[model samples]
Target: YTLMSFLFKLMEEGYELDLTYVTERIIAVSFPQDCFEETYLRNLRDVTRMLKSKHTDNYLVINLSERKQELTKMNPKTLDTGWPDFHAPPLDKICSICKAIENWLNADPLHVVVIHCRVRRNLKPPSQQHV
Candidate 1:
């Protein structure tokens, strides 16, 4: 498994591969690490294919990372968001995240929600170090 796979396992059984199923209509995936134009586009294509197969049609992506600006510049289609690394999100952000998820899930039974964030290693500080 790649380092990214080690960080987030496929939560459900079946053909999802690297993607994790949080629910039948909700999936989780690692943020594609390659930001370079060519590779990132390829990665986006692959991810889009997988999501299409799973959701069949409608889907909403909720990205939870501080890298939103970079990602937005790369792909204008996505709705970008930010949450600080290694710390819990502030109450307002938490409510907004939950609200978004709830809204999407309630909008349609077949609508799939995909959430992405950087891997655990990037999300938290080294355990061996002291602040």
Candidate 2:
């Protein structure tokens, strides 16, 4: 659960946070809703120099949490298995997801996008081949 651990990393870096890497440049993260406490930046102070030591690139982030309802809405479907009503994601939805990724990639050569979610969880295994 590397994604789950990212919360600890963010905490280690001084802000209690969480993030999940979906695929490619798309990642999901969580943050405090009410207000951002300054304590986090203070915690990162010790490693500020080390962090600055790395030079990295341009990026843009798109958080779809605002569209959560639309995001999770799924169409009724029929599965080809014993499991009943096992609806698969719609093709149109898949196309939209791909387009979003494509748009992010098109934004910049080195640009990476991280999305923000409302919860902390990872949807992917550490490695391919079904872990």
TM-score of each: 0.64, 0.38
RMSD of 2: 13.0
What TM-score does candidate 2 get on C-alpha atoms?
A: 0.38
Alpha-carbon lDDT of model 1: 0.61
Candidate with the greatest TM-score versus the true structure: 1
Tens-digit lDDT string for candidate 1 (51-85) = 65555557777778766654454334455566666
Q: Quantify all predictions' global Cα lDDT against the true fold.
A: 0.61, 0.41
Clashing pairs in 1: none
Tens digits of per-residue lDDT for model 2, 70-127: 2222201111111112235567755665676687579776655545433323444335
- Alpha-carbon error at 7 in model 2, in Å? 7.7
Clashes (N, CA, C under 3 Å) per candidate? 0, 0
Lowest-lDDT window of 10 residues in candidate 2?
A: 75-84
- What lDDT does candidate 2 reach at residue 15? 64
